[model samples]
Target: MAGTLGIGIITYNRKDTLRGVVDSILRHTSTDFEFVVADDGSTDGTPDLLRQLNVPCITGRNKGISWNRNRILWYLKEEKRCDWIIILEDDCFPTVFGWERPWIDAIERYGHVNFMPELTIEIDNDISSGRGTPEDPFIAPMHQAFCIGYHAKALSYVGYLDTRFEKYGEEHVEHTQRFLRAGYGGLSQHLSPERGQLFYLRGGLDTLPSHSHGSHELAMRNKTIHDAIRHEPLYRHPWRNDEEMFEFREEIARVLPGPAPEPEGEPQLFDSIISLGGDELVNQAIRNHFGRPGPGLFDQFIAPFHTLVSLFRHDFSGLLSTNCLYGYHDALRCRDTLLIYHNCLEKQPGEHASVEMFHAQLPLLRHRFHTMIQEIDSLCHRSRRVLFVRSWRDGFLYAGQHRPAHVASVDFQALVDALAARYPSLDFRVMFVNFGKAHATDSRMMFANTDTPDTCPRDEELAGWSRLFSTYRIGLHT
Candidate 1:
């Protein structure tokens, strides 16, 4: 009888890494699963060494990562006919608990589906490695193993990874997004950082980063492929409705995929920002407020606040760099948390839309607001809208009691001014706060009282946003 699962690993010239990945998988996973090793014309002794291993493998010409993966998909159809195929990278390894029956059980429960195994990055010594661990092994948007997926229909639908990426990045996310667009539900494993650490020893990267040397060629190829994808529009799931598109976009983020699984026993730290409403509205407001609809207030005022807060709360650096991470962390935590928030107003907004934007960008505004619930992982909870209100005199009230290190109530603009004034050399920046129609406004001189809406027509509206922001760790304007 044939095994139910097969593994497809894509490799280039990294022979040692490939060997380690293969050895690790065979050792950890006892289930009779076929392993498909697809090579992209690795000039290094990778081709010869594969013959020595005597494992079921596939060899192909020097195409991109996406094409290499497609070639393996071809093998699965023509030769293996596997019930399911697990896709992996040569540098990644599988943990002893990686082949747990629960994972297979999850596949059986939600089978023939494209799933993103849980992903965790292990920084062993200076070398960072990503492998599946027992605790938090679920589907995600990074370099991860695709599991519980059959060899036939999925291949036809996804058509292998996008050949745009000659070596690394973009392929996994694009593939997963395509599956989701096709109305296929995928299972994401729920494992922890601790679980992810088991397979990787701490060490710096020993091999040459794939695209570093040939960046110019890779960039040109990526541009060509991306242009093609634009016209062709790769995602075509049956469930391509507006809501699904928004949701799929958000869930499809490359940065910290999904909410950080609540640490096993700890109380959750960051709250949901979805209750605040869509950033599109804020972008629109900025467009209307300013003459030019370029990347202005929304980029300056709104994006920074969200990005900075997100940096502290989660490692979801979808499009941000390590330098940015270090800078953000240093700014926020170096002194008192409140002080950091107080001082950060002078920073510039991150202008580019990165992995975070790709995942969070809802094609439509209303749908975008609805999809944010997934980011917080509080989809099941009561929703609230967040608003920041302030008066020149009530600055002390906004300061509040001993503030949580992670959040502040004052207007972000004020924080920037304070920081800029204190540090003459630093450039203070306005926090990016998308103000959609949700922002409560009143013609009357007095502020609206939300509790008694009839007496204060604007009160309910203002209170609605206040409640929303508060739930999401945002503070109310005094």
Candidate 2:
């Protein structure tokens, strides 16, 4: 009996390469299988291309490779209920006819298979060796994540790829190691046929366009995470906990609408209104105002030090970029309100250094702030109006209570002035909220302040805040 088979192609921003691979697969393959594309937030015309090809696709925000692969695994194994699943990257192409036959057979015997592409001299040498036949391929250690196959039984035992891995690197190696430790057979390799090889590597294709969104910093960070948890017990779920799992599932249910439809004539750009601050206060206010919150690139609670590092380095990969917002790109283009908050300068007992330390870092802080505003301006080019809500420093409401010593020393207004002067096209407005003694007077604010680090205004107060924002729409100010 021939078991059901599902083939998934994972793609990012490679529209031309994806089109070639999809065409190649359709022309060269003659197997009965379910096919789908897992798109990782490709802003570059890939959605329309997929619709033109009429291929079923599963898409989400620009999470890293591991998370994107999990979308395929979840859809094929859990939703489609296929007995065997084969994963291929957009850059990988099949050169031989009936290419899916050997892979299906190999998975039936070994439970998993990773095809070796003819990219390097060593791989070319291995393929020349006539060790394994087409019917039953040679067993080798799992390497290379470009093309892989997994049995449903093996998937049930192993689990989904770890989403903690940011961008690219180390995720595939860790996953394959876990598979081997679980007593499953390693990947299968075989000699090439006279017609062509089983798969063609992206490196060997010189005619196609080459584009990479990965960086050394992201790879190094992922390597550190791999080293820390490679030896731990296997994780059988995609998410960190039940809450995350349920949240992700809910997001999938809400966003995954089968294959994407062709976009209407000439995509229109909408004016963007965004809020950038430090912490969940900003997120809460946006959520309260919109009646529902969309996915934000920096929606989570971030530490003051890390936020500063992100600004200084201009690194927005990993947690800083990924969020609960499902169709992040689509939502970002249409949504009018965006809230970006961090806790870099937030005052918490023992959480920050002495005021003297902040003073010493004032120059670096100003430079980082300048870099941050420049980046924001570049990112929100579609928006004509941008608003920065400056949350008050701790103890701002209490009389005679001293604020964090860094508050008065750092000149945020100067940094904004320099950048705003350079970029004349964007309208930048800064609003400072001073809830003078409101914590003591207002019962809602009082109750909200009972929790440490919850210095944001309550949901009820957001209505008045919105009205105040509309009142100050005259010109750019600090």
Q: Which candidate number has the best lDDT?
A: 2
Write candidate 2's Cα lDDT for 167-243 as tens digits. Answer: 78878777776666665544222231111222212221112335667889988999899878866776557777654
Per-model TM-score versus the true fold: 0.37, 0.49
Lowest lDDT sum, 10 consecutive residues, model 2, at 443-452
lDDT of predicted model 1: 0.39
> Could you tell me how far off, in angstroms, the CA of residue 244 lies in candidate 1 after the best superposition?
35
Off by over 4 Å in 2: 121-136, 139-142, 187-211, 254-478
**Ten residues in a row with the worst lDDT in model 1?**
444-453
| Clashes per model (N, Cα, C within 3 A) | 47, 5
Q: Write the per-residue lDDT of candidate 1 for residues 246-356, one digit (tens) a residue.
A: 322221121111122212443222211221112233333223322223222122111333343443244323212212321233232122222121121333465433323
Best candidate according to TM-score: 2
